[model samples]
Target: MSSAKVWTIAETSGRRLKPVSYELPARGRMLADKLGTRLASVVIGDQVDRNDLQELFWRGVDEIYLVTHPELAGFLVENYSNVLIALIKTYRPEIIIAAATTTGRTLMPHVAVRLPAGLTADCTELDIEEETGNLLQTRPAIGGNILATIKTPHHRPQMATVRPKSTKPLPRDESRSGLIHIVKFNPNWIDGRVKKVGMRQIEETGAGIQDTDVVIAGGKGLKKGENFSLLRELAMLLGGVVGASREAVDRGWISYPHQVGLSGKTVTPKLYLAAGISGAIQHLAGMKTAEVIVAVNSDPEAPIFKVADFGIVGDLFTVLPAFISRLKGGKAK
Candidate 1:
């Protein structure tokens, strides 16, 4: 007898697959295996990028379910939800994971209501229980003071919208391979309650933070908004994005989109370099998954060091400039 299926819904930005989309297979493989099932992915768009899918094969996905339609070319919440709901009904996957992005935050809820299934949001980690095979969903809660583990004890096709940068995408191995199953999509399948009449661009938080390999974040220790220029310059030198602790954002030192904490964007970067941050729990909840964390704070006892891979007890104003200078020197070479 086949066990339940595991599926991940992939996301795209500017027609390119988002980094978190690529990172999901690593987790999918684990969950699927724990359930003794196969792992698959779903790509839904108006015009799916066929070429970029080779990386998914290397990531150990057993199959890629490609659903393309002219209507899906642009994101209409109703249309996307309709299509996903169709796939869920057809394939009957036991678990579905989506990125906790604007689209996902909106889309998943719609589908969940229709499926009448339980859905969890902003999960930082996922595991399967050895005893009951239930999905173990973990995240920071209560102002990030507690790490909560939740499960949908009675729901079928358990759904979760995970915070971006929470898990590493499986590494690519050309030796691995998979099948791409094209789902025939029909435009008339949707009710058309929502329409993408015109497009406007509004700023959102943490671009490079959500997808980049490196992130340079600042805190109140930066002193003022103007001081963020140092962090920006360093980000430029390092080819990374600039992030802010909630303190910096509240102080008007940076915008809310740049905040990294329980209330801000969660990040999974290869390197997260934080300066002047005291390492509050809310902040750690957002970025404790960074492959490497380097914290620089004047106070050696700052809580950030508890989770940091490297620490420097020093004044950030002095430390950041020196770091930027060193990066610039290396770049010049």
Candidate 2:
């Protein structure tokens, strides 16, 4: 029934497999099953840990292509893309999916250009067309206003990059069976144009924003940058992290990393508490997937309330402190 295989790129960071990497296998497995083909994953890095390999199998990867080279130890766009381009040429897979994280967003496009394949970015959903067996890539298009489904009918390897939190990983099964094949390639394929001469890793407290259980985000309603401390206090009390809207960052109230919106990061926390942010469509696009949304605004007609599960039409200055007091053993559930 199937002619070829469904492939996904498994990415690692900080020397461990990123959570988003597992998400690819979860999504790729479903499509592979529909096409009656096996799901294979390719990981490119200098080091491949044994534990990480087993973790991929647990997530339902049937085979692993270990693409490694001394030059790939550091992420150079040219080197990484060349390795994948070679792999794609050799395997000629039917479909290729990757995580929509920074690495994947940068890497896939380079490979696509070399292979001259049709590629889509930031896809929220993926499916297989029963009649044509085409890879149906669905994503938010045109300023996140409409959902668009794109198909690469003419491309040999249908390619797509999936948003990190859009899908969940399959449960890990230690008993799952699979194989790891080390891939060898010519080191001369690399062209040293861009180089990573220096790097700094800032430690962000709490779990990652996308994966956090609770997120406390502020916006223009805060009135001033200094007020972010109020948010930080509440975040610490709640065992959560602080998030911000584009306006807050634009006003120099917070750093860019904490921003949440279409122009920023997409987050899917279990509980999202928004303060002073008048739910712009762009802001909503980033956090709409959160399981539970709580909004606090001075205006009852604020757009954030339209999507929030619970809303308080009042001043965030008062509401935030009150919540902090109540949670700090005062008397508020």
Candidate 3:
């Protein structure tokens, strides 16, 4: 019934969790489900605890491979590339899905060069063809306007790197179980160019935007950088994070890291509070998955209100202060 085996890359660090690591397995499972085949996942690193691998077993993986070596601890390009290439040469999977995170994006290009496989980056969707069993990788091209579908006819495994938070992680069932194979790895060929100098975790601040239940997102409508304070005040009052549309970042009103759009981070907060944003297509691509969207714009015809569950046709400057005061009063009670 199946023509090819699906493979996914796994990675783990602190409890913080790399956004792309979980995303790749979900994409792998989707392709496997369509192809009616077995899903396998491979992990590389020296100190990789089996906790993340055990979690993946429940997410539809039939076999889990671990290429462990002391030299492969914290994502060195050379060692990871070597291990992944070896696996590709030996196991010969039909489809390989890697997350488009910094590590995945970096290592994927290297692995592709060695394996000579066609690899697509930042893919939004992946599926297997019902008739030919070829992997169909879809990603945005030409500034998110064109959706390109890529296929590797000659390559053994079709490889892709998917953007984080683009797909839902498969439901974890603790009762489900699978096998873990510890592949013996020897650091014979890899030249030790970069030593593990040091490692530090970036502390998350002020209700991490990704983990927030509510987010007050501001756009260029605030008119000036100073006006962001109003949005920040409301966010602080609500105990939420502040997200910004791309236009706001381009206009130098906010940092690019805080920008939310096709080029930036994808967010799916429980309740999204949008203020002063006209909602361009790129911006919508990021937070369209939010559970509830509330748009506060002076213009009733703003595009953001179209996708919002609650639309308030009023100036955010006047609206936010009053809203914050009321929330503060409620808290005092």
Candidate 4:
């Protein structure tokens, strides 16, 4: 082996690269530079666009490991893990990072066990320790009330899954250059135990909260599940999606997909409207990165006001209808 390098697993949907694929290299490049190592990205799919793969180099990766085969079209944990394990054994990277999406949450643990390496999941932050060169993984712990930093000092490959949208991708630099190495697929690596039959696509009302430019989120102060309808209406008027704090989701006011917090999806919308939320640290962790934060709470001392670009001190029931009325071209009392 020449030297230990940093690796980022590229995530793809169909033949297109996911946004997090670029985000990984942006972050990985920083860590690699800190460790005085090279940054590489592993891309696996069938007939994936070469142009999409090349963008990784523009983002920051110094090397690309491309694995393409008909059998690899659909992601099977067994097949993907086998391929990754084989590559790891050969390259022996010092660090590996993947997005904490569905594929990553499922695949990383399986690969970690097979490689017998320590793994961290849903990390909010990653850093390189100066003296030890350990990958520092930070995540919310104890019900998202506190943050914990972990390190795999004894492991060969420091593995971590980072939450999507936790950080921004680096600006593309067309001047950057890298080499792509084609990795051969092994037929025997495919296991008969698991097979992909089909994939189902669920119909959603509008764009996902994560993808929307505006987000209207409610919390425990909304009082009941029915009250979430007000949020839905406001979201509709704003051409956005409705999101819920953990408390509202816990109360069954909305589905988990609409949740925004440390335990849920991280959103970086252009405008985030929080209603009846006290702004716990966990909830803030997810939406604080929004360009503009507007909070509405009855309590003048609510923590949400601390981060809000605009704050309103009033009962949500009274305040919401006024907003709805104004947006509808009706005069507000």
- Among these predictions, the greatest lDDT belongs to 4
Candidates in order have lDDT scores of 0.83, 0.85, 0.77, 0.86
What are the per-residue Cα lDDT tens digits for candidate 4 across 225-322?
A: 99988988899899888988999989888888888988887777778999999999889988887789999999999999999999999999999988
Clashing pairs in 3: none
lDDT of candidate 3 at residue 118, scale 0 to 100: 89
Clashes of 2: 0
Clashing pairs in 4: none
Q: Per model, state how many residue pairs clash.
A: 4, 0, 0, 0
Model 4 TM-score, 2 decimals: 0.82
Residue range 1-333, candidate 1, lDDT tens digits: 223399988887546666777878888899998888888888887565666677877887888888876667766788888888888888888899988888788989999999898888878789998999889998767755678888998887899888676677787888987888888877666667767678645363355567677899999788889988898898888888999899999998888778898888888778999999999888998888788999999999999999999999999988888887877788563
Q: After superposition, how far is residue 176 of candidate 3 from its true place, in Å?
A: 1.7
Q: Work out candidate 2's RMSD over C-alphas.
A: 2.6
Please tell me which model should have the higher lDDT, number 3 or number 4: 4
Q: What order do you get sorting by lDDT, best first?
A: 4, 2, 1, 3
The TM-score values for the models, in the order shown, are 0.86, 0.91, 0.79, 0.82
